[model samples]
Target: MKWPLSKKMETSLLACAIHKGEKLTNYCTDHNHLCCSKCVELNHRRCLQVTPLPLAATGKSTDFKNLSVSTENALSQLKYYETYQKDRMKSLKVSYKEHESLIVDGLRLEIMSFLLQCETSTVNRTHEHMQYTVIDMREKIKYLLADFEKSTIKEKKEELNLKQAPLKVVTNSCIRLHYELFHLHVAIPKVLDKPELSFIASTKCLENIQQSDIFIKENFSNKVFTVNGKSVHNVKMPSDSFTCDILAVCALPNGQVLVADRFNVKVKLLNQLYRVVSHLDVKQKQLGMCLITPSEVAVAGHDEVQFITVSHSQLAKGRKLKLQYRCCGIAHHQGDLYICSPTALYKFTLSGKLVCRLFEDTSADYTVWKCAVSPTGDRLYISSWYKHKLLTLARDGTLLATYTDPALLSPHGLHVTPAGQVLVCGWLSSTVLQVGWEGQSKLATLATMEDGVRWPRSVCYSSTTSSIIVGQWEDDTILVFRVE
Candidate 1:
């Protein structure tokens, strides 16, 4: 379990951490000294020689000769955590792009609505003015007509003996004619606006889909990329729907596909027709395996995972059993789920019963992002997101062999093909790796960056066609490699 960094090597990498009074300086200029000249004299009076930090950093002068298991584990943990965060950012980018269209559509509608309201206000004002003018004209006409009725035409004739006053009366017939043809005094709303809109739908919330491009900075699959490739199927989703980061993929016997959506905390089921017939939602910190079944699901929690029914109204509440510490992956064997962690993989039954517990070496810095059981269910292959190698462990936690070659860059997502080929994903560099049993032989290639397979998650083989179904994590697509 311990790394083989020699004492000589350890000493070469060591640098001094100096402390004086209450101050601490890391890798300072002075060798193993506590502080400045004054503090060194004060704190190192009882010790041996005090020198500059550069001297301690040198291979010959350092006090420590080797790195501990704990130190290596801490380093591995930090590296994977950074990688995980980076992947999240990539996912955010995809999500932002998906919302662009929706934003445009919503803005257009809002402008039209505003303009419609302005036209409606104009029409109301014009109608009010016309009504007042009509009312005033009618009142004047009525008064004149009444005055004419009170005095006869003869009286008017006598009063106007010197000058005949022409009789004038406003009639209903005149008013009717005026009302029949009227000019608009106020602007009527004719512009397109909210009120004029025949149909208007409220905008919905935007959903984002992104895949973080986090992997090893260096890559080495250039030579074997072609032989490993398969046909790509970018299983498309809706632009408006929320997208899930595909961390894991497994094919069912009926051609149904099971996906581990690490971010959305759900496991989805897709039939051969690509229909999502069933789904399970688990409310846990599922950075790795947010898995699913027909009626229930097993999800990874921080320290432990929960086995819960999919029918639960709330996701986190139905987690039937609290699992081991820091659960990362789930493997279904016979009647139990193997809970994977850095230090251990535990097996538990459906009713929250503890069936067995498998422990790995505590000293080894192993980070298991995904685990897969062999077809026979006797072997377990674990993929490391940070380590330089992959591990083959027995069901009872025995180390079968290690796969550490120069070809892989950040191994992740393990799967055992029905034909017994061990499949691994090269995270940073976009490659699918294959190895024979016992890590004795390489399967030439599976899929690589040159073949447009980047950051693949897992690979499944179909017996019907002898094709490899690869889940490309970063691209949010599936590439199927047919056996040629």
Candidate 2:
């Protein structure tokens, strides 16, 4: 059947998009698509109510004016939406700038506040030092004057005859005192104004304070501990096949303990009596664990750190932080995470942001094995497993001291008690030693091979139960030392 086609219609309408050089002649009512003969044969062969364009439009009541008005209204609405989106983009830019400025200002204020605190502390210490110096000087002067007054003329002449050695000694002492006082007076103002100098001075002062504290604790505090009792608890689960190699132990405030089972790739939670209550299986082997909060803990895996929560004695896995470097040991201090690679130690935020690399020793692979922070968060203790040494670092990564003892062989685990006593276990020697707070010397030998501490891998002190929990390698049982 031949249909009359107008040339004007052919010139005005577009060709079929799918079939090149073919006009859209038929309409498919079912699919609501304009189709050419080839499109109908290939794509819409079963579409119902297919009609030619002229037949479809022949008897329809047309409304050209209303359709044109509706088209104009739709275009206007689209343009208005475009304009509104552009305006929203501008507003977002403005808000971003404002937030940036606020963040920068807040950082500046924080720095200023820290500086002010440092200045005030430095000034107060300087004043106290000056006062002590003046008092000492006056006391020495008074003693010298009294000695002269009490001496007879014959004694004075005899002393003068003896080359006046005592007088010369007194004179030199006074000169030295005067010089020290003068140096302090000249150095205080410069240190207060300079940030770097102030920080260094503050660190030195903190060290001195720590040393003094250690001295007092050793001499006056009488902190003596006798092993009240020892109990061994097995943490092997029934679903485990291999001998449990417990690598790390963490104690919470509520007397619960979390132990990382390296052989089974699980973190087990223990009740107050040190019995396994619940456990969470992880994908990777966990090497270390530390308490992030009273009810939260972080487990250090091979390539990431996983956070877990404990509620009502049940264990639940939380978020995971993926990292580029391997995480062997983990410690938390003041919302900052101290992660240990085999040869380096890094500081990171809780949200997976890297802060800085605090320390690194690439001489050996297991040189930087495990870490622990002091209760005050000013000192960091790292165990060098291969070297049989312990490294003490400041908050800013300064190596304060390195401690080595004959009893401490292949130190693996480190923990600081609430009273600031450091406890470290020797993996090779099968011994646990109590190190001083300053990390200068070993205070006491806590346990030995005879005490059944074999290859102790981790150690933690629980203030809630007043016990020392020790995790061992190739041992199914953990040792708990009750101390008074």
Candidate 3:
């Protein structure tokens, strides 16, 4: 079926070089043909140099394909070599497919944000403690105003410091509880609110201690994300007024970045680049939001789909590759690309070809409005806006369980943290909820006011910085919350 260039073509050309009126040499480096020194000294010499060729008759030159085969085999082994390689990168998928439900990326950011808030809260508690110390000193003055004894008043400051440790321990206990709640968030019965009393009252200090309690009750609250001054920029709006999102971003080793701006519909190639780069109004309106993978760029819209290349002079003019649905979010797993939409999710082969619709759950009445896959890529958490509930789905699309709480009136957003914790936002309640897997425990409120919360339109987590950025529709302001 296959043949190498015949040795006759090679040898005949060599013999012609020698016999057809040319001198011979031991090597012909420049001409790449056998030639003599006489040929070099002649016009041929001034024209080219002579170099030696490998022994053709001895199968040296003939083994070129074998050499190529050897290199190909070496490369294949390299693909699996531990020191030389890692697991093949999957498609920059829109979904994780079966890997949808391990650890959630967004939730990890929240937990990290919560952790940061913890440190700030602790500092706030210490400040309150110092203020109380001053109050205690004043109380001793008031008590001795009538008794007027130096030794009696002197016991107050020493005793207050000695008693401070237990109060610190109680506050630490609540902090621990908060951390635990962030992990296992389910709406359980409220805790007893067994707040610790930092100051104790004896007959001598009764009135003063009561005042301390009143002061603490009035001022005690978690002090975190008390923003002094923060700013944000690089806001972009799509031509069709579609909501844009920063779907995915990765910083290169050189500090360059590739960002997938989904709604504005562009994969922006960037360096340390400008701080704010808005998307230009794309001219080719044939189909779909444009999303670029590391290798290929695909133009997609609500009703049309086409895969193309960036280097091509005109992507709209390039060969169009057809796809089944309007693609949305994409994710990368073990060498396959997964894409998601409001109604469905899909997997694709490496060749820009459709593999299959991996997740398609169209109930009789409602459709999935939003979904997020866990890190290990084994499960998916799907949310239905119409039904006001959530479903934990197996990789194969089986409904494993439904999660909801009476307190969850309007669940607008959902995320799973790396530690297997679920975070949800309630629009009507204006609160963020951390719920447990089995729906038995919960942090009834996170970062919401006692009166009520305004509807939070969208939320994202910055894992590198460990912060949660939420967009509040009603407040017309963005809130950055840190995790403890």
Candidate 4:
């Protein structure tokens, strides 16, 4: 049935058959088509849920503002990958030139005269391969530029203003671009696949070239981390294991977890299955623990930092460095140790040399508790247990930003994922807050006490299993959650 045409319909151009001269007024849900009164009578007579076009537009479709923000964020990440690949290409070019020089230097005068033809052929092949890789990288850069252009300011503005914007189409296009960008990030490094170069006077040389393994793992959670089931996977330290407060937790690449018991002066290592594999006794009480290497760890507490080596689930004390003040929480990034005390942050070399006092917040309620460094080693995230806030700092210790929210109460432990998402344990709130790398946005409540996270004091993330481990202060139990 046709009603009086609305002002908009009257002013808009006709979108249906000329013979009927009818305006499209209804949307047929079953047939998925827009229809005029005559078309509906002829073709959609039996269709169910034939809704008026204006009524169909009443409900919200997609969040244009959030979409624009997400698109811009993805673009920024792509730009980071592009810059990284370009740096790799530069290094590859330098190495290629070095190898070429080595070949020329190694060729003797008489041997060069006899093997000139073979040398020229080998050099030409090597040079051609390098040039090919360079060209491939350039093409990848162009592709990323094109993808970024789609999310430009003008395009975003136009999309936001559209009355019937194709959100599904735009979303699908973005998903496809995200997949391609992730794979490109993995493949760009291998374009200049490392090739062994050697020079032989009489015989031909065989150079083995192997592409590095590529792993494309993308976290689309937007930091909305959560516990999957009614119960969190938790393991408690046995009575015989140790009687102490669990102050710090660190997850190793091999799926083992290292926990520092502050009162008992012990460090315990848990296997992949959350089983206690071994424990090490330290002379000083331990408050913080961090993995220095796959086989080594740095333990800090009571005004001293100790390095311990691990092998076959066994721990052996190696080196000890004395600090002027007590150490509470620790993190290692690029051969440097970041230690957080009650009032100050310190940076030190792995060899025990003091680097500099990064910063000190002497405010009565703003005690810095734990620290974590982003994978890029650019931003440092610290939890303020007393102040109930999270602080983001640059590598130079300059305060970048501070994050405080009602959900974030007495923040304790801090961990930054390789993806650059920041995770903070809210001790008083009994919840974990998943934050953005910039400390400007709170993504989600990663977990809560109801989910078996009780007074979580320490937190760590494992890339190997995509799991997060939480160590509680009062409780002896440790909780683990698998994240996507």
Clash totals, every prediction: 20, 0, 53, 0
- Rank by lDDT, highest first: 2, 4, 1, 3
Estimate, for each residue in 272-344, the C-alpha lDDT of model 2 and write its tens digit.
8899999999999998898898899999989999999999999999999999889999999779999999899
- Which candidate ranks first by TM-score, i.e. highest? 2
Q: Each prediction's Cα lDDT score?
A: 0.50, 0.74, 0.42, 0.66
Comparing 2 and 4 by TM-score, which wins? 2
lDDT of 2 at 166: 36
For model 1, how does the per-residue alpha-carbon lDDT over 1-484 read when each residue is reduced to its tens digit? Answer: 1334344422222312233233222222333222445565656655556545434434432111121222232233223434433433343334344444455446546655654564466546787775565456556645754555444434533544322111111122222222221100000111112211101000000000000111111111111223444455544444314445666666654355666565555566655654555666656645454334644455566766555443422233464556546777777755667777775667777665777776554555556656777644557877766775778887677878778766677777676654345777777767777776455446566666778777776666554344567765545567777653
- lDDT tens digits, residue span 1-484, model 3: 1233344422322332335654233344454444445655553655544443322122222232343333333322222221111111111111132223223334445545654565456546787775565456546545644353333334543554454544455444434333322211111111112111101001102222233233222222111223232233233433424444443333222223333444455544433332423332343332222224433444444433445443322223344435566544443444455555556766665455777776666763334544555433445665555566766776566677777666665555565443234556655656666654433346445556443345654444433233444444424234445554
Which 10 consecutive positions of candidate 1 have the poorest summed lDDT?
A: 201-210
- Tally clashes: model 3: 53
Estimated TM-score per prediction?
A: 0.46, 0.57, 0.38, 0.55
All candidates in order of TM-score, best leading: 2, 4, 1, 3
Worst 10 residues of 3 by lDDT: 195-204
Which stretches of candidate 1 lie above 4 Å from their native place?
1-229, 239-243, 273-281, 285-319, 363-366
